[model samples]
Target: MKKMTAMVMALVMAAGMTACGNVNETSSNVGAKIENTAEVQTTDEQTEETQNSEGAEMSGIDGGWIIPDEIDMDKNPEARAAIEKTFVKMMDAEYEPVALLGKQVVAGTNYCILCKVTSLYNHTRQNYAVVYVYEDLEGKAEITDTMDITLGNTENGYAETGAENIEGGWSISDEIALDKHPEASAALEKARETLVGAEYEPVALLGTQAVAGTNYCLLCKVTAVWVEQPTYVLVYVYEDLEGNAEITYTTDFTLGDADEEYSETGEEKMEMPNPWVEYSTAEEAGREAGLAFNVPEKLGEKSIYLIQAFDGLAEVRYGTEDNEISYRKGREVDDISGDHNDYNENSAMEIDDMTIYLRGNDGKVFGAVWNDDEYSYSYYAANGVSMETAQADITALINENK
Candidate 1:
C-alpha cells in the first residue's frame, strides 16, 4: 500500500511540471506577436509622416497681383460721378498740407489734419489732404480741420517745387476711391472736350497705345481746348509731365435718318499701329516688389543704375538735390525721340559685372552697373516691356529678403 502511494505522488509531480512548461511557451508567443505588431505600426506611421512633409512642401507657392472687381467704375454710378467731378480735379491740381499739432476741441467736435513727409516720393505724388470733420454736442457737423496736399515732381529733366504746407502729393488708390464712390468712371470726358480741336505737338503724345496693346496712352498733360458736355464749360488740356497720351478718335459722324456731309482735311491722317504686348516668366525677373528708385524733387543732373540679379533686373535713376533715383522701368520701346535731336542717335546698353551702362553716341558711362562682365548689349528704355519684367523681378526679390 505504501509503494502504491509513493508512485501516485510521482505521477502528480510530472503532471504539474508539464503544465508549467505549457504556460511559459504561451507567454513567449504572446510577447513576440506584440513586438511584431508594434514594429509594423511604427514603420507605417513614419512613411505617412514623410509623405505629409513632402505634400506640404509642394503646396508652398506665391500668388502674384490680382485686380479687384469693385474697382470697375462702369458698373457703379454714384461712385463714377463723384470720381469724375472731384477726384480727377484733385489728382491734376496741386495740394497743400496743414499741421494740426497741439490742437484740441470739444468731445465729438474736434479733429486734426497734418502732412507727414515720410520720404521724398511719399511727400510728393503721395500727398494727402487730411480732413477732420466732427459732430457737435447737438450732432451738428463741425469742420475741425483740413489739409491740402503739396505736389512735387521728383524726376529727371523735370523739377517742380514741391507743394508747401503740403507734402505727400495727393493720391488715391482705385480701391479706396471705388469704395467711397462706386459709380464713377475716369473723368476723362472733360479731358476729351479739351482736345476736341487744338494743335497738339508730337501727335504721338496725344494718344499712344500701351505696349500690351490693351490700354490707351493719354498724355499726362493737356494740350488742347474744347467744350464740355452738360456743364458747357470750355476745357483746356493740361500738361502732365508724367503721362503720355496715345488714343485714337472713335466718332460717329452720321445724321439721324440721313447721311451727313462734313468737310474733310485735305491732308490724309495716317493711322498708327497698336503697341506691342510682352510677357515674361517669374524666373526672368530678379528683384522683389519690382525695382526700387528714388526720384528727387528736382531734375537736371541724373544717375541711373541697372542691376542684373539672380532673381531679376532693375533700373534705378536719381535726380539732383536728393540721393534718391527717379524710379522708372521699360514699359514700351519708343523709337520716336519726340523731336529730340539726341534721340536720333542710336543708343545701346551693355552689361558689365552685373551692372548695366547706357552707351550714347559718345560711348561713355551714361549709366553704370553694380557688377562687370563681357559687353553684351541688351537695350532697355523707360516703359519698355523687358524693363517691366526686370522691375517685377526686383520687386519680388525685395519682398523675399524683407
Candidate 2:
C-alpha cells in the first residue's frame, strides 16, 4: 500500500543552474532587468500600447519583460509547438498554452508564454504559470524557466515554482475549491472506504504528483475511533493508469491554524460516498450490479457486509474482523471471483441442480464455485470453515434469493 513514484525531474529543475547547458541564468539577468516580475499583469492598462499593433506584437521594453498588448497563443505556432515538444515528457503538470506574454532577444530566442496548468489526474482546479522557452538557432526547444502565477505575493521570488518545495517530486497545487475535482473526490471516497476504524472528514487537496498516472495529497481531519479525539493527517492516494486507485499512506500532518473543513452535504449515517452507485449495502450494490443476491442470516448480525455491482458482475463480502467469506455472481460464464489462489484438494457436490466445486487444503473447504441455469456463482471462505459448514452457508445464500 506504500507505493510512491520515483522521479528526478524536480531534482534536475532544482539544480537548473548546473544541470544543463544554456540554462546558466547567464542569458541576460532577467530578474534584475525586469525589476519586479510579480507586478507585471496583462491588464487593459498595461496592454494599451500594443492594442494598435499588428499580429499580436510583443510589448517588450528595452530587453526586459514585456506586457504583451495581446496574448492569443493559439495564433502563435512557434510558442505552442515549443511548449508541446519541450513538455511532452513532463508528467508533473498538464500545461495548456494560453498566450505569448513577451520575448527577449538573447544568445537564443527566449519566448515568454502564459499557460494554464492542470493536474493530469484532476482537472477541476484552475492554475496559471508563465513558461520561458529558449529556442536555439537549430530550432531545438528547451524550457529555460517557469513561474507559477500567484495573484498577490510570489512565493519563490520570480524563480521556478515547482522545484524548491518539491518533496518526492510532488508539486503543490494552488488554492482550489477543495471538494470539487471529480477524480480527487472519487479517490477520497475510495480511500475513505478503507478507513474502517476512524472518521476522516476531508479538508482540502494539498498537492499531487504525476507518475505512471497520479498521486494526490489530501488534508483530512481524522477522529480516532471511540476516542472522539480529532487530529490532522495527510492522506496519499495513488491512481494508476488503468484507473485502479487506492490509499498509499497516511502520515500525521500538523496544520496548526491552517486546517479547514469543506462544506458538508448534511447527510446523516452516510458511511460511504455515493453509496448506491458503488461499494455499499446489499440492496444498493445488487441494484447497481443488476444481480439480486442475498445475505444469509447464518452470517449473523455482527457480520460486516460490503456489496458492489457493475456491468456483468456483482460481488459481496461477509466478514467479521479477520475472517471473511467473499461471494461473486454473474450471468457471464466465467470465474467472476478474482481469487486464483491454489488449494491442494478439490471435490464436487450437487446443490439445487448446480454442481459446486469445493477446493481447500486436505478437505477444509474454503472455496466453492457453481453455475445455476442462468448465472455463474462463486464464494471463498478464507477462515478455514469446514465442508458441512460451508455447505450450510451456501444453502442459506441460495435459499433466500430464490
Candidate 3:
C-alpha cells in the first residue's frame, strides 16, 4: 500500500509539473556539454548568472533534478556526465547502458535538449535528461538543465510491459512476494507464474488517468464470478527480453467498519477514522481504499475486479463518501488557471457535494457546484481580478517590460 501511495503521489507531482509549463527537453549527454560553439562569452557559471538575471526559472520538480545556476562542467563535460556521477552516488549502484536516445532543437524563444537512457544491468533505474534555454527581447540567455532518474517500475515506452526491481528501488514486486505469498516464500514463484501468462501495456502519458507508463502490463487475477463490470483483481506484470516475468498485486476495494451519519450540519459532510479504508460498493458514495484480496468462489473459476495502480512508490485510495466527488470519466482538473476575459463568468460551484470550477464554454473559469439540477457559479470576484487574470496581466507586464 505504501508503494502504491508513493506512485500516485509521484503522478500527482508530475501532473503539477505538466500544468506548470513543463518543457520535456532531451539531451544525449546525461551531463555533458557541447564545446567551442558560438561565442565563448564567460563560463557556465557566468552563463547561469546571465540566465538568472534574464529571468529563466525552473520549477521545483524538474523531473526531480535541479540544475544549479552554475554547473561544474569541468567535472563532467555534459549534463549526462554530471547525471551519471550523481546517479551512481545516489543510487549506490553501477550500470551498463543498453540503449540511449537523444535530440536537439534550435531557433525559438527557447532551445531544448532531451535524452532517455536504458540499462540492462539494472532494472530499477530509468533515466531522462533535459536542457532548456530561452532568450528575452534583450537577447540574454536563460538556461535550465536537469537530469532525473526516477526509481520504481522502469518500463520500455513501447508496448505493455512491467518494471524489474533492480538496485535503485522500484518497489513493484517486493511486497507481493515478501508479504502476500503463502508465508512469504512463494512470492517469486507466484510472480513467475502470473507474469508469464499476463499481457503488458505501456503506461498512459498525457491524461489525468494516465498510469505511470505505457510499458507495464496490468496483471489481472481470474478469481471467480463475472467477466464484466465491477469485479477483478489486477496486478502489474513485466518481463525482460530474456522472458523473465514479475508481478505485483494490488487491491482497489474500500472496507468500512461502520456507517455513521455526518457530524457537520451543513451540506459538506465530514467523518473521521474513515471506515471505508479500502473500498465501497456504492457508486454514488464510498471509495477504493487500499486493502484487496483474491478469494475463489470455487477452484479454477475466473472473475474480474476493478484494480487501481499508480506511478510512484506510495499507495493512495480515492476519496469517497463525504463531498462524494467522484470523477469517473471526466478529466480531473487541477491548478485551475485561465485568462479573466470576463468578470461575471468567473465563479465557483459545488458539484455532487464536491467543490469544482464551472469553466465556461468561452474558456473563462468559475467556481461552481452541481445542485443535482444545474450549476450555481459563485460571484466573489474580489476587489481585483482572479489569479488567472492576474497571471495574464503579469505576462503582459513582463512582455511590456521586455
Q: State which candidate has the highest lDDT.
A: 2
Write model 3 residue lDDT over 1-402, tens digit each, in one string: 213333334334434544564522211221222211111011112133323422222221112122222222332234334224222212212322211112121221322323333322133434432333333334444333333333222233222224433343333322211223331222224344422212222211110112332123222222111111111122343334454444432321110101122111111212111112222232222123212222112111212122232121111112233211111111112121212334444445332344444434345333222211221112112223344653332232223212
Clashes (backbone N, CA, C under 3 Å), per candidate, total 83, 0, 72
User: Once model 2 is optimally superposed onto the true structure by TM-score, how far is the C-alpha of residue 162 displaced, in angstroms?
Assistant: 34
Give the candidate order by descending lDDT: 2, 3, 1
Model 2: per-residue Cα lDDT at residue 86:
71
Model 1 CA deviation exceeding 4 Å by range: 1-125, 128-172, 175-352, 362-365, 368-402
What overall lDDT goes with each candidate model?
0.24, 0.52, 0.26
Query: Could you tell me the lDDT of residue 217 within candidate 3?
Result: 24
Model 3 per-residue lDDT at 143: 31
> lDDT of candidate 1 vs native?
0.24
TM-score of 1: 0.16
